[model samples]
Target: MDMRLEVVLLPVADVDRAKQFYAQRMGFRLDVDKPVKDDYRVVHLTPPGSGCSIAFGVGVTTAEPGSVQGLQLVVTDIERARDQLIEGGVDVSEIFHDATGLFHHAGEVDRVPGLAAGRASYGSFASFADPDGNGWLLQEITERLPGR
Candidate 1:
């Protein structure tokens, strides 16, 4: 079986605003923006260097706006990624790492105030949200775990 995850449909109060935030602020590539029906619009976007894409627009999802969370993007250099987002007008959080050497705690718990020594894989993170409050996390993982 060749199952692969593709697009993530995000819900937003305003389609144009969310499109601007993702395309302008976060620098995601705007792949498609077209109206299919009188009440339906589809906007597709992809992050830089990413295989997966995200879609959101009118009539696309029934989920509440700003309700999605914990979406993650893996990066090789956490600090550089954070700085780029900050420069792009995003209010990114400070770099931090998990203390237990396993994984991070959710929502500001178990966070130490620095990147892990040697920039170990799966050790550091920074987070930010879209204008609609859909949360996204940047996790530094220079190497994948065995079999991953």
Candidate 2:
């Protein structure tokens, strides 16, 4: 059976503010914003080239705002992506790479300054957080690994 991930529900204190951040600052396309019931609302947004979208609104989720962490957005060029986000008023972290040749170490332990030598795929990363402190990581992956 084939299973495709679709939407992710993000918890936020205010719907309009979160909508503005995603739609304007993050440049995610606004897909839906509607009141579902007396106290229920649904808002959906999709990133520029993403198949999976994010949703946030009243009565959508019980998770606490800013509780979500370590969400990742993969890009072909880490520098360019980080620059765009910064230009869009996001406070992004300086480019860094992990010392380990494999996946990055959690938190900030193995982080090294600057991009990996020769812009290595999956080697470089930058991070930022939304107004409510929803953490996001920008991972550079130019090529997919075999069988991926």
Candidate 3:
């Protein structure tokens, strides 16, 4: 059996505001924006070149707005991706790598200045957030590991 991640649900205070942030600012493609009833609405979006998508809206989730964190988006070039995000009006962090030369520590614990030495795959990263503070990390993966 092959299981795949298809959609992630995000909680938001205002659906339209979240929609604008993802669709206009983040540049995600809007797949759906439908009201199932007077009290229920769902907005679905997918990032460019991504198979999984994100959804948010009224009555969709009980989680608090801005509660989600550490969501990652993989890219072939961290610098280009970060630049595109900045040009699109997103506030992104400066590119950095973990001091331990492995995965990054949570919440800026071991963040070192500048890109990883030799620009190793999966080593460089930048961070940003949505209007509701759903944190996102852009990880530069130039090559995939075996079995990925």
Candidate 4:
């Protein structure tokens, strides 16, 4: 079972705006951004230090904005990240706790749904939304679980 989840698609109201936000504001590197056709522009971006990238476009397909959903990002520290986003004027949810201490509550993350299970093996964290109402959850792992 070596199936790799290399890419994920995200929807945005404006391609250029979203591109800048991810590339400049959020610190993701631009993978690809070019005109594909008359009404479509293919854009791909990778997070600062990750293997996977997110692809998005305008008029490329009929996929509606805020529909792609559910991105789980684990950070070394959740409180720091939350503060940064909050200082940047992004609306963040109150931290909540999952059954596991490693997971925190982010009250009603607008679009994307919750996690599956056992993500909080280390510590807990929370999330907020991007400009276009897309969801982004920052999970903070406190420690390592038992065993390998």
Candidate that scores best on lDDT: 3
Ranking by TM-score: 3, 1, 2, 4
Candidate 4 lDDT over residue span 1-148, tens digit each: 6677788888788888888777776777898998978788899999866778888887655777876544867666666766776765667665444543434444443322333244344445466677777787766665656762
| lDDT assessment of candidate 3 | 0.94
Q: Give the candidate order by descending lDDT.
A: 3, 1, 2, 4
Model 4 clash tally? 6
Give the least accurate 10-residue stretch of model 3, judged by summed lDDT.
101-110
Looking at candidate 1, the ten consecutive residues that score lowest on lDDT are: 99-108
Off by over 4 Å in 3: none
lDDT of candidate 3 over 53-139, digit per residue (tens): 999999899999999989999999999999999998999999999999898988889999889999999999999989999999999
Model 2 residue 98 lDDT score: 82
How far is 115's C-alpha from truth in model 3 (Å)? 0.8
In candidate 4 the C-alpha lDDT for residue 117 amounts to 41
lDDT of 4 at 127: 61
Q: Model 1, range 94-128, lDDT digits (tens) per residue?
A: 99888886678878888888888778899899989
Q: Model 2, residue 116: displacement in angstroms?
A: 1.9
Where's the lowest-lDDT run of ten residues in candidate 4? Answer: 109-118
TM-score of model 3 vs. true structure: 0.98
Model 4: lDDT to the true structure:
0.68
lDDT (0 to 1) per candidate: 0.91, 0.88, 0.94, 0.68
Candidate 3 collision pairs: none
- How far in Å is the alpha carbon of 5 misplaced in model 2? 1.3
In order of listing, the candidates' clash counts read 0, 0, 0, 6
